[model samples]
Target: MDNFWFNQSDYEYEVVEPCTYQNNHSVELLVGQYVHSIICILGFVGNSLVIVTYAFYKRTKSMTDVYLLNVAIADLLFVVSLPIIVYNKLSSWSMGPVACKLLHGSYSVNLYSGMLLLACISTDRYIAIVQARRSFRLRSLPRSRLICAIVWTFAFLLSVPTFYFYNWYEPLHTQDVYMYDGHEKNLTTPQFVCEFRFTNNSTAWTTKVAVPSTQLAVGFFLPLLIMTVCYTAIIVKLLSVRNFQRHKAVRVVMAVVVVFVACHLPYNIVLFYDTVIMFQHQMCEASDALQVAKTVTQTIAYLHCCLNPVLYAFVGVKFRNHFRSIIQDLWCLGKRYIAPRRFSRVASEVFVSTRRSVDGSSDNGSSLTM
Candidate 1:
């Protein structure tokens, strides 16, 4: 949502006239706010479940799962910041400077960390599948942890500049600001809008031009290129295999790529366009339309945080059993309908033995472990 805030005043206009840039879209504003609340709640619950699943339930995990655990950690952190975003949309920012920077910077860190992690997952999958029966160097758990640490470090460093740009700025002219209408546009409202500001010509080139340029390049374009190369090569190798199951690991790979392109690409495109327009200092009359588009696309982008659990984790055969076990345990309802039936005697005996051994379950009680 912070990425979608393209304040019209953030852009310079050479032609001056008695212009009234009031957002008369009350219905759209209400709908966007409703979507904001829904995404906040759903993303929080979904990502929290992901963290719980990986932390307390799953005992053994692959290298891909390790990356996913860090991804879930990033999403959970970002989901907690959703209230800040909703508050910005619904009211003026009253929280102090530290809170503003922390909230906005966390959003930036999420953007950078999530994409980089997904790219890492794709690369790992490509190696595991395409390089089947071959040995690779960085395939161990230690290396996986090191990769995650590096990603977290890089993500925090990437957001360091955001602390400089995002600050509470008083309204110089309410008419030109074009704040979110959900703020009510009170004529007597005396509050600061926490946002990224260029301040003057000296900082404009760096804040407006450079920051967004770097964001689009590293946050979107570079990840897009990496994902494209990895997934394409992976698909080629899968097609050549004689016994590759179409509905197995392959479907999960396709889902990841499809979800990424669908949810995040439009927002990134709008961001890239905004950066270019700012650098060119062009004046456009379609600011209202562009604002609505950006808001909608960014809201759609929030779906990715919720969908990561379903698309990546729930799609796995092993995770499905773990999810069912957790749900059954939470409700105190035994798994009578959701679990798959084991036909062979040996398989059923193994399932019962493993379930009891893994979670220390008794005839009466069970733990969260799986």
Candidate 2:
């Protein structure tokens, strides 16, 4: 039988008995249901706010704004797939093969695009700050949009493997032996699982190693390297400047890099180890440990989606002000719709003053304080 999950290493061991390993069904269920539920809800809300603030409220969009808006869109797409994933883990993929491929393909596409857009954001910042006058034209709105188009196209291309390989599979497990008339028959039940299924054993290396390695190299390491270099230069530049916000800007950049590493590094490391072990035979205990680690670390990595808006957008003073304005406007609109007379004059005055302050303090450059 083919591997049941994408993260499972390519190895087979003799099954001497059923229930030989410790059961962690309850723990898996808890994490799959509760943890993922919370991530889905928070990621949805946070990314939605970012998208709304950038797409509707902002009259002028900077290069960074364009990159961030795409990042948020990628994140929202990924967040939408969480419920299906969680449900699949707990029960079965009732959605069939086409839905399975679409969901998994979309997940991979967004995962790659989100990370790439973040790298683009860093590159744009580097151009805008470190090489400002020399590269002004490079950071134009039209160019940024063109770059975003390329990112989406490239991401879709990268996800072609997932789209081709992922499908709903029902693997049969032998339960017991039964005597029927003169012969004994093995009774088995089928459990549905959505995973990568290769055409033949010859493609095991491609499915087990090449696919995941590509994901790691392109999705994590490349972007991490780009961000590290860009931010390091940015920090050095900030130190040479006499601006009061330089220190705060440096802090924000550091936080962004640190959080990215903290959230993704552990999972990538685990996945790397898992990939390496695919070549060697392993005991059941070792395999079990690796599988557990992959699940837990993967969940932790998923939290990064929820944290993106906070790290990228909400950290900016101007973005926060814009977000506040959106909230205030929604509040005022709700009050007016519910009870027009109850919409206090003082509330209107406060709202007007807030908008004035926001508009006055905002710059034509990136909403990011840097």
Candidate 3:
């Protein structure tokens, strides 16, 4: 939740330049735990619904739908881990090194994968609209699938370091933790918490400087750059078109760009600030301020996972229709099973996918691009 390896602490750290905050952390801790729990539940359900609706209930799909399906899958993968992160942050990491490695790796993979998929979606949209008459070789569905595979493979490879560095270390002081037995008891003991560390100085340098810098650039900035350019070009092209709903297309493009920047920019800014502080060895009150800022901003970014479905549900007409169909089918199913053993009236027909015109209008799925 707090980036890949960064965690907040209420007490001063011994070997790490005494990175402690002067403010009372009780509010932050209490709010963070519950918010994480709530977001975990909502994000899981939202992402799962997106995937299920697109995968099963929708019989028709454009190239945009394929990209969105993968996006939903990636978000769901990360959403399921929020509860574990909540437990780890509220309590300590009790799941051992294997669990820590898996969680960290999954987080990194999910982060980069979602960003890359958004970039891909934007590029696909650019090709679909701006280069609608050109770039014939790149618009095929099979090509889109190949591009997605490449994106996933690249994201997974970039995140492999998280698996390697997620090792445990013993804290210098004893921690008071609760134990489960016949009855609950609190006891003091030396505990191990999850952290990213390396023995060799060179490896440490790479982990601290190179890996995160690359993540900051490729995972956050690059996708942002891609979307900005793509949407700008899309807007220009939309202006030139005299027919159809060009204004709607431009508004949708702008909305995608705005939502992405709104959700992700704050966290990246704080992350960059944290990196600068760490690299500069600035152990001052500013460090305390940045620590708090980082925690707050990271929470904002975590909301992005669930926000995707909400954004789509509002903007995409076909997505809303598909969701309505699913709800109606569910209601009819519930009425059939619970209200009576036999059908009292003719069953209502449920349409899985929304109908499209002969011109292959993509107003349904185009709103999904970041």
* TM-scores for every candidate against the unseen true structure: 0.78, 0.87, 0.82
Deviating ranges (above 4 Å) for candidate 3: 1-17, 20-28, 173-187, 242-244, 312-314, 342-345, 348-370
Better of 2 and 3 by TM-score: 2
Q: Against the true structure, candidate 2 has what lDDT?
A: 0.84
Over 4 Å off, model 1: 1-21, 24-28, 133-136, 174-189, 244-247, 279-284, 333-370
Clashing pairs in 1: none
Please give the clash total of every predicted structure, in order. 0, 0, 0
lDDT of 2 at 2: 75
Arranged by lDDT, best first: 2, 3, 1
The candidate 3 region of ten consecutive residues with least summed lDDT is 350-359
Predicted candidate 3 versus true structure: per-residue lDDT over 46-151, tens digit per residue: 8888887766666324566777788888889887876776567556678888888898889889899989988887887788777767646666678778888998
TM-score of 1: 0.78
Candidate numbers sorted by TM-score from highest down = 2, 3, 1
Question: How do the residues 270-351 of candidate 2 rate in per-residue lDDT, one tens digit apiece?
Answer: 9999898788877777777777788788889999999999998888777888899988878886776677777766568767
Question: Model 3 shows how many backbone clashes?
Answer: 0
Among these predictions, the greatest TM-score belongs to 2
Residue range 264-353, candidate 1, lDDT tens digits: 889988877776665453344466566667677877888888888777677665566667666645533233234435334444555565
lDDT value for model 3: 0.73
Candidate 3: pairs in clash? none
